[model samples]
Target: MSNSLQYIFGGPKAWDSGLWTASDDRVRGGSSISHLYTHPTQAKFYGHLDTKTLGGAGFASQRTVGDLALDLSCTEGIKLSLGWDSSDQTFTLNVKDTIPGKREDGRDEAGVSWEYDFKAPENGGEIFMKWDEFKATYRGREVEDPEPLKLNDIKRISLMARSFFDKQDGDFKLYVNWIAAVKKDDNDSDDDGDLKKHALEQRSDPRPVWKRLFCGLL
Candidate 1:
């Protein structure tokens, strides 16, 4: 191993409830809603997902409050530590390279977003996703042969609980211990590296609690 350092994005000691906001299917006349509750040890994401209103299509997610100019160029992948998951439903993790401006009608203009969907772990574990694992998507549909993700300036991040074409719905809950960027080790092969465990212990930091981490942490 090259002994590269892992950069923290959202962790127990760094999570800020105000930094997460619900972005649900309400915009599409659906009732799906989600919330992110920040605790001392982890963050809880739970909500009721309704697909009836949208005719078997609905989604509820928690996204970063604002754009984050994060430079992940030095990192190879993202690491997510799972706490406890009540439902082993499929969830999506999204990263945006650019944020489009709002239209005159006060609605957001659609833009390309990189997304990676994974089945939530039944118990608790960690998942490391490489940059290539994310696919470019627009308005829920994958784009064919899209441009690469801008790793130097990651604009946004989101976690979503969506209805996979009406396959599943109802109440859902997910617990997350942390979200971080892992560096590529030198001994790693061409393929994704070994699934080594990421350190989960939250060490005591002496800095004042700041909600916006990208300002300095990145």
Candidate 2:
């Protein structure tokens, strides 16, 4: 079967689907909140980041429901269509492959997470990320001894706006036109050339690092 880009979120289905919002307020006595508003053409993620309570560390995020699992091994990576209203504020796109079972105390176990940070352009554009671009992190810290990402068992995807340890705070908004898996094209020569150009461009203009320890990688 020929590989093709597949829509994971946005459009009509996302409009009716349930997305759970998670904020640091639950853990730190802050009042930050996040919301996902979906329309036929796009999804808007907007929220407030309260840094005062935790001494300049706060975050707001939204993620897919627990039952949603996507196998994207056939694709190269994800491509996001950003809308005009998308801000230049840094945002992290996180993916999880394993969902650990709950502990005896009813809290969820910790698992490795793959994360990539990007800044959306003011006029909006397509952001393409190859599989290798995602860095491994656990419990918000970069893992030196990282495990390979399980592409066939993607469990969750999240969009987050964080304070980045006092780097930024306050209200935030991001407009996403769609999120899709980018499949390799059949024309190898043409695809290779395009991918090479894209990789060079991405490397030339790198995004700011959100994880302090991973600054060297950026």
Candidate 3:
């Protein structure tokens, strides 16, 4: 019964507020971004952490459109259903092809950061992160033998809740219905004939939304 991996975002034709966007940076101890309702089905991504506000770590981001060819060993990465409220708050799943270099540009920030460490389960439950149990760190060291996670150069995908300046904070909450990029043959059996019909005959371009939004439609 393992055939349920096909969602680009939160579901139900989701696209009411244009995917998402809000990269807060209120000095350091930051908190100022919120979206509580947008539903054809369900969509709620919130942010707030003002340990005092200054400038060093504050986040709220969303980006897409960078599928250079996505195959990552037939994809078996990307799956998030998050929930948080205090527990100090921290959630970052940043995929990159470049977007690093801060500290007021002092050189030393080159991209490659995968982080997943969330806590808000002291009797409350629901926070699952699986992209092969993500924990990659590059440019800061810790990404050894890390390769299988290529949603094709994945330009950008960010969801962050951070407040690192005023030391720590308390008010933070997050919730997402669905988000998937996983494949990894999705429980392969060895018949190799129906990989989505050989990925739709390797698309010779018949214009089904430009072969599902451009990407070697064949």
Candidate 4:
């Protein structure tokens, strides 16, 4: 429905539940569970997070069923359109440039992931996640000076609700309308330069565009 947008999900008809599967703490012997209920308008991600099962650490997530093999080189970043009635819980959006093979136990081998954590608006709205906003992480720990995300050949996507060091636990839900890659154009606002107050974007000798933006009045 957008001119400069390319949808990875949320198409013309009902969204497909077959494209996702729960990858929750249950696999790790924890009690948490999650599901993605698909519909024509949106998908609802609902789950119960039981941190006590694993000594106060738990996570619930729904991830793409298989490799996506998307080439997003042209887009500036990813965009998420949140449906109304979405919860205010912090959800992590993850992108993987590669998928590792499974161990003999059938558990996936841990690999680097690009993650962005955001709390959806109470009434739901659009959230843009610029490439610079994503952090390289491995098994939930930040990786310093890691190679930049392999944006061109993104292979997987996942949405997670996790106990942030016991900061959150219990029922959680998020309504997702669509997920797409967005391109900035002549008419677009360049607010991506606003200082997020996170680690500064990887610097280059010539200073990136964000170097010129001020964060005072936003």
Best by lDDT: 4
Model 4: residues with Cα > 4 Å off, grouped in runs: 1-3, 11-13, 184-218
* Model 3 per-residue lDDT tens digits across residues 34-148: 4444465445556555544444434444434333233333455666544334343555566654455566645334557666656545444445456667667763346888765
lDDT (Cα, tens digit) per residue for candidate 2, span 27-114: 4466678888878788888888878887877778887667445556556899888988776679989899887678787655676879
Task: Point out where model 1 deviates above 4 Å.
Answer: 2-5, 186-218
TM-score, prediction 1: 0.81
RMSD of each: 7.8, 11.3, 15.4, 10.1
- Summed backbone clashes in each candidate are 0, 0, 11, 0
lDDT-sorted candidate list, best first:
4, 1, 2, 3
The C-alpha TM-scores of every prediction are 0.81, 0.77, 0.29, 0.81
Candidate with better TM-score, 2 vs 4? 4
Error of 1 at 150 (Å): 0.3
Off by over 4 Å in 3: 1-50, 55-73, 80-90, 99-104, 107-150, 154-160, 163-181, 184-218
- lDDT, residue 33, model 4: 94
lDDT of 1 at 140: 88
lDDT of 2: 0.72
Model 4, span 19-81: residue lDDT tens: 899999887899999999999779999999889988888899999977776656546788899
Pairwise TM-score winner, candidates 1 and 2: 1
